[model samples]
Target: MHVPDGFINAPVSVAAGAVAATAVAVSLRGARRELDERTAPLAGLVAAFIFAVQMLNFPVAAGTSGHLLGGALAAILVGPYTGVLCVSVVLLMQGILFADGGLTALGVNITNMAVVTVVVAYAVFRGLLRLLPAGRRSVTVAAFAGALLSVPGAAVMFTLFYALGGTTDVPIGKVFTAMTGVHVLIGVGEAVITAATVGAVIAVRPDLVHGARGLAVPLKLRVDGRLVDAPAAPAAPVPAAARSTRPLWISGLVTALVLAGFVSYYASSSPDGLEKVAADQGIDAKAREHAAADSPLADYSVKDVSDARLSGGLAGIIGVGGTVVVGTGVFWAVRRRRADDLTAAATAAPSAH
Candidate 1:
C-alpha cells in the first residue's frame, strides 16, 4: 500500500522496522537455498517486473483502484524467500528514488506489503498445490487463490498495525471493514494478473518456475498387471555458458519497460485501496509530505518536463532501469555468496575425509 510518513507513530514504525529487518535477514539465509544458477538471474527480473506492473493501477470499486502487491506472483514464480527480497527491493527503490512510499514508513510498508503478503500467500499456494492435481493448471489455480487471499491478508495486517500505532483517532472496526472490503475487490485484480503471469511462465519454461519445480508427473510404466516406475533416462547436459538467460532476460526487460514506460499512462488515476481507505477513515489526516517530494522523479514525473506523457514515461523508464540495476546487483551478490559457500564446503569435505 506504500504507507507514507506519519501514518504510524514513531514507536510502532520503529518496531515494524525491526520486524522487517529480521524478516529480511532470515530471507537472505533462506534464499541461499532458493537461488541457484538457473534461478538466480530471474530474481532481478521478477523485482523489476513487479515494480513496473505495480505502476499500472486498475480500477476496482467506483473510485478506488488497485495494483499488484506481487507477493503471490513473486512467490509462485520464484521462491518465497526470494519473493520477499524481490518486493523488499522494489519498496526500497520506490521509497528512496521515486518517493512513492515514505522514507520513515519504509519498515511499515515492507512488513505489510512484503512480509505478510509473501508469507501468507506462499503458504496458501503450497497448501493448494498439495491438495490439487499435479499439473500446470493446478499451479495456475494455486497462484490465483494465493494472490486473491494475500491482498486482504495485508489489509488485516495494516488494520492491526493501526490498532497499535495509528496516528489518528478512527474506530478500529470501521477501519478494518473499509480496508478489508476494498482490498477484497482489489484481490480479484491481483488474482487475474498473477494467474496470467504464472500461466505464461508455466507454458514456456516450467523449470524456471520455483513453485512448479516438483509438480511434473513422474515417469511410470505398466508391466505384468502392475504399474512401476520407469527407468530414468539421463538428461542431456547443457554447458553453463550455453544455458543463456539473455533471451528471456531481454524479453522480460523489454516487457517491463513497455508496461512502466507507456501502459502506465493509461492506468486509472484513482486513489488505490490504501489511500481511499485512509481518506475515508481519517487515517491519512496526519500524513506528512514525502522527503523526496521535490526530487526530479517525484510523483512519477520527470522534472521540467512539460509533456505529461513524456515526463511520466521518462520517469517510469528511469525507475525500471534503476530497479533492475540495483536488484540484479543484490541478487547476483547473494548468488555468488551461495556459490562460494558451496565450493568451500566441497573443498573442506575432501580434507575431512
Candidate 2:
C-alpha cells in the first residue's frame, strides 16, 4: 500500500502530511517511555527485520500477493509507539533509497500503513488479551487476530482517502468493496506471519517481547484451608556473557540479511494487494513517476551491476544496513533523552526538599 504520487490531490495530500507529522511527533514522545537500554537496540533490529520480511511477498490470490505490514508484529514484539516509528523508518528508507513508495504521497502512506494499522491492531490485541487466557499462546492468538483486522482497517482508511482526493472518478462503493475484499485475503497472510514471528520470539526470550511480559502467573500455595502467594524462587545466577543481548542481536541481523539477500529472490513476482487493486480499478490513471526513480538503487536494482541476482541482493543488503543504522541512532537518542530527563527530575526533587 505504498501510495504513489498523483493518486491523491495536493490539498488532501498536504492534510495527510500534517497528520503523519503530528503522529510521528506524538510517537516520539511516547517512545521515550517505551524504549530503554534493554529494548532500544531490539527496536532497531525489529525495523530491519520488518523491512526484510516485507520483501518476501506471498501469493494471496491468483494474481495478487501480500507482505508483512509489520504493524501488529512490531507492536506485539515491542510497543505501539515504537512500532509506528519502525514502519515509518522503513517507508522513509524505501521512498528515498529504493524508489518504492512516492515521496510526495509519503504522508498518505504513513497515515494508512503506520498510524491506522498500529493504532487499530494494538487496541484489538490488548482488548483480546483481557478476554483470553493468560499464556504465551494467547499472546500469539491475539496477535493473529489483530493482524488479521489491521490490513482491512488500512484498506478502509485508504478508500476513504481516495473518496476525498482520488484523481480518477471511480465509484466510491466499488473501490471500497474491492479494496476491502482483496485486503481481507491479504490479511490472512499478515496474520500467519505475525503469529509465527511473535510465537518464536516469545519462546526464545519472552522478556524481550513487550506483549508477552507479565503473562507468567505467580505461584500459589494452600495453607490451613486458605490460599496464599507462594514465596518467589530465587533466580539462578546467569553468566555475564549469557546475559548479554549481543548474541540475539547478531542472530536477528543475520536472519534479516539472509531473507532479504537470497530468500527474496524466490518470492512471488506478482503485484501486491494495493497495486493489483489500483490497476484493476483505474486508481493509477494519474500516478506519477517516483522522484527517486533515477537513483542507483531505484527499483531494488543496483546501477552497473550486471547480474540481476547480485544487484538485487546488494540493494537488499544495503537497505537492511541503512535501516538498522538510522533506526538505532534514532532510538538510542530517544533512550538517552529519557535517561537525562530522569536524572534532571531526581536532581530537582532533592533541591525542592
Candidate 3:
C-alpha cells in the first residue's frame, strides 16, 4: 500500500524515514554479496517488472482491487539485499516521477512495503523450502506459499503502524480485521503470480535464479561393498559474458511494456484494497494531498493530452521507460560502487598483496 502523507504524523514519518535510511545503508553493504554480475542485471529487471506488474490492479472484491507488493518475488528471484534495493528503486521512481506514493511518507512506505514484506517472505520461504523436497518443483511450491503469506504479513505491519501513529481515532481491532481480510485474498493473487512466474523462469534458466543456485542434489554411487557418495559434478563453467545475461529479464521487461503501455488502460477502475478499506472505515478523511499532484506524470496520464488512449498510453510508456532508466541507474551505481571498493581494497594490500 502506498501510504499517503496525512495517514501518519510527523514524528512517525521521520522515524520511519530514519529506519528506511538505515536499512538501505545496510542493504548497500549486503548487496555486494548478492549483486555479482549474474544477479545485478536481473535486479534491475526485477525492479522494472515490479513497476509494470503493479500497474495492473486485479479485482479482488466487487469494488476493490490489489496488485503485486513484489517484495517476496524480488527477494526470491534475486536475493534479500538486492530485493530491498529493487523495491526501493520502484518506490523512489513512483514517488518522484509518477507521484503514485507520497514523498513525506516515503520512509514509511519503504519500511512497510519493501523491508517488511521481503524479510517476512524470505524467512518463511526459506523455512518452507528447507522442510520440503529439494527440487525445482519444491522451490516453485514454496514460492507460492511464501507469496501467499507475505501480503498478510505486510497488512499486519501496516495495521500496527497505523495503530501506533494513526492520525484518526479509528478502532484498532476493526482496522486490523479489514486490512488482513482483504489482503489475504490479495495474497492468493500474489501467490499465483509469483509461483507461475518463478516456475517459468526456472524452467527456462534455473542458473539465473539466485534462489535456485546450489539446488542440484548431489550424486550417489554404488561402491565395492556399499553405497557411497559420488564426487560432485565439476562446477559449471562461467562464461565471462554469460554470467551477466538475463533472458528472463528481457522477456519480463518486454511483457511489462506490453501490459502497462497497452493493457493497463483496461485495468479495473476501482479503489485498491487500502483505499477501499480507508473509505469504508472513514480513515481516508485525513488523507493528505500528494506533494507532486501537479506533476505531468501524476495520475498516470500525460498533460494536455485529450485522447484517453493517447494520454494513458503515453503515461504508461513514460512510467515504464522512466522506471527502467532510474532502476538501471541505481543498480548500476550500486554495482560500480562495489567494484570500486574492491579495487581500492586490493590496491591497499601491502607486501602480501
TM-score of each: 0.96, 0.97, 0.94
Model 1 Cα displacement at 92 (Å)?
A: 0.8
lDDT of each: 0.91, 0.92, 0.86
Model 2 is weakest, by summed lDDT over 10 consecutive residues, at 238-247
Q: Taking the tens digit of each residue's C-alpha lDDT, what string does model 1 give over 1-353?
A: 88999899999999999999999999998888889876777889999999999999999989999999999988888799999999999999899878998898989999999999999899999999889999999999999999999999999999998999999999999999999999999999999999999998788778788999887677889999999999888998977744777777788999999999999999999999999999988899999999999988998899999999999999989989988888888888889999999999999998996
Flag regions of model 2 displaced more than 4 Å. 222-227
Error at 118, model 2, angstroms: 0.7
What's the lDDT of the predicted structure labeled candidate 1?
A: 0.91
Rank by lDDT, highest first.
2, 1, 3
Say which candidate scores most in lDDT: 2
Candidate 2: lDDT of 13? 93
Scored by Cα lDDT, where does model 3 land?
A: 0.86
Predicted candidate 2 versus true structure: per-residue lDDT over 111-183, tens digit per residue:
9999999998999999999999899999999999999999999999999999999999999999999999999
Clashing pairs in 2: none
Total residue pair clashes for candidate 3: 0
Error of 1 at 114 (Å): 0.6
Model 3 residue 173 lDDT score: 94
